[model samples]
Target chain A: MDPDDLQAEPLSSGVPDLPPSDIGMSVEPATEAGAESDSSDTSSSSSMLEDDLLVLRRAWINERNSPELYTYEGAALENLMELVDFQLQSLDAQPASIQNDRVKYLVRSYLRTRLNKVEQHPGYVLREMKERLSQAELEYAEGFRSLQDAHVRKSFLDQFPAHLRRVDEETKDGLKMVPEPDMDRAVFCRVRTTVGQFQFDERYVSRQRRPAYLVQTTNMQCVVRTRSS
Target chain B: MLGDECFKLAKEAKDVTPDHIPAYNEELVRLVTQESRYLWRRVVELIQATESSSQQSSSGVFSPSQSTSKPDLSSQPFSNDPADVSRSMESENMQGQVALYVHTIERNKRCLMAYHRKRAEFLQSLLWAVHLAPTMVPQNVSQRLAPEEQNYAREYAKLNMKYRDSVEATLCPNDSLDWALNGEVPPRDLLIEVRVHRDCGEIVTQSGIVNLQAGTQHYLCRSDVEHLLTIGYLEHINPT
Candidate 1:
């Protein structure tokens, strides 16, 4: 009945365990049983249960209205908390029942239904919440890693080493060629920081057609040859 | 019906003047659209692997082109009559109708998937809401139901649970909601009863409290009454 009482309590710490029988005190016994005399008693009980349920429903609605990013686990916890609020509100909103026997029965139903759900699917909410939190952490780490890598760049020439070499050749047509390097070309390329390797070979045809140059290299690889424009 | 309509217009083309080309054009569009629909359905069947024959014919390869690439209608030679040729040409003009169908089906399938995903997300959220709500009990618990009503709910639950395997067969032949909607509407109020025991207390098995607020009339329109009735407050019936 009092919103203040609920709001005053620290909801984040989790809901306090409620006395089972006292949760829903508003449900009235069915009219058929005590139609003539106990109508008031029935109404009183029903009203109490209804009020508490209304409050619980409101709490659940509020929790659900959270931002788009809240995980299902958090949502589930919010739901459970609201449900407890609904039960408490139900007790205060409706008049207390005179029929203790009926009240007991109704309370037992509420507890059984709820507790069964909790037991049947134990720790489901907790697991979901933890998973969402972990996912958020992972995403954050990925973003941070990406940010850290902003300065990193692969050598532009590395992607197309052959193209870079061709440009250099076009700029300066003739370079010294020692037809066959007297020393191993590999050792020279490795030791000299500025030295880069280039490969070329000419296959001789029967002196009838233009000799085709066969060029290959580990320096650059292309899935398909791109013809220079 | 569209195909039939097109067929009628094509036959009457001889009687109408050349100016009545508009009528022929309209009929052509309808015919092509219908053909496209047929092609679309077949293509979808192949793509979804719903065609048993296609699945059995090939060990593992899935090629829609094998099933749908050739227009089945193409093989049906057009009548020698110039009028028939004209009509067929108009129908064919509707832009390789089968191609249009494939495009539309793909788009719709994507939309359906997105819609289902969003709906699932919403339902998940709703469940969470229900879980959190206050400790409230039902507003009313009916007194013991008359013996007859009790027996009815019990029998209904029993039938549903007992024949559950068969229920799938009986409920909808195609089992797909789309197919069910297109087919005959199933029966109303085919009730089933099953006895469910609770740890807290025993609900009267024979009788139930019906909340007038919750009724089958709406669900009956969208779903089979039998299917809807199979769920809810069955074991909670008040016994007389």
Candidate 2:
């Protein structure tokens, strides 16, 4: 449990050899029977293995789930290294008994492999997120450029419905209207109305009367005024 | 050693020098390139198969046996077989297939870049940790690194040293501590406001166990409720 002792030894010295058993397959019945026979003698060892497994599993899960970055400072890293060292020592002390339990051996190997991955998981995620962000930025830029190109090629009227175009045309027509004088009398004229030609008093047209016009053009009412002398 | 045997076997297989560990860069690159090519072919095949199947279905001449007799694409070993390559190339769907292949390659390249970037960052962090606390650097962390990663660590160390003084001046105390430790500063006694998202048991803290309920807000030190925040049971509210 001494940190100094843990730090003194090279980790390569503690690393166990590759398990002979294939991880995908279930443990052989012979190994299981052997494990059961020596169960009483190795109770403490088994419990320690179980404890180490739980801690490592939790650390692995946390490494996967946590938003926080992984580093060497955490209790999990220390605990994992310590457990690995312990497992290596046990394997050295009783090679036959340790190797006989196929399940334990598999767990140890799997744990070792996972520890490496777990340590690197945070960096992997950070890199992924950054690359994804850059990709998104590129997409955004492309989208913006396309939008600008579309906008530049067509006016708002051409891009939208005909109704908006008509409204724009009417507004331009309204703005173009001016009082025309012919010898002090105003001349008023109507543009593009469906109503029959009718005479209205100059005062009525000058007052901007609305109900007096009975013409509907493009679903909109239009009033015409001209000044005449 | 348990795991050391595996490395030894791999090293022997690769015929690496005794002093130099096998980085497996060439092997990984070859494998990835081959796999991508295989995947490209598989995708093209799948698309063509689906297209032909749909055409047959529409023509009211669907044959289940014919579709079933189609070669198992997954089992087909990837090779530079001229016949297979030429056959795929000659299809009228070549344009679409080529486009798909290009897109797949781009995505694969991006993934590889991300992986390398991750490794680089990990090495940089490791180097920084080693610089700050040599005793704490685990032997496994240092020994297992590839040659490229070792180079990355050396480069990062140089850059860090160059910017050390300037960076220290600009960084907040907490950030400075984090940089020095090469990790996040664990929750301590800093006061924080948190809103409960779900009902739970009272949190045991240095002061006492404080009752928590949904839709309730509490002002507590960070150390007392850091776990709750991590688990999404509570949310930290910024004072600003």
Per-residue lDDT of model 2, residues B1-240, tens digit only: 212322333333344333333333545544444545565566667677757755644453245553456544664463234544454454546556656654554444333333344444455455544553334345666575555455445544544443333333332111121233212222222578999999977877656779999999998766456556755788989743
Candidate lDDT values, in order: 0.29, 0.39
Give the local distance difference test score of model 1.
0.29
For residue B148, give model 1's deviation from the true position in Å.
Answer: 30
Worst 10 residues of 1 chain B by lDDT: B176-185
lDDT of 2 by residue, A1-229 (tens): 2222111000121233332133212223323433655645455544444454444343333222322222321233233334334444444533222222233333233332333332334233333332322222223323333332232223121332222222111122243111111222221222222333333432223222222222222111112111000
Global CA lDDT of candidate 2, please? 0.39
Q: What TM-score, over all chains together, does every model reach?
A: 0.17, 0.24
TM-score of chain A of each: 0.19, 0.22
Give residue A111's lDDT in candidate 1 (0 to 100). Answer: 25
Query: Chain B vs. true chain B: TM-score for each candidate?
Result: 0.21, 0.37
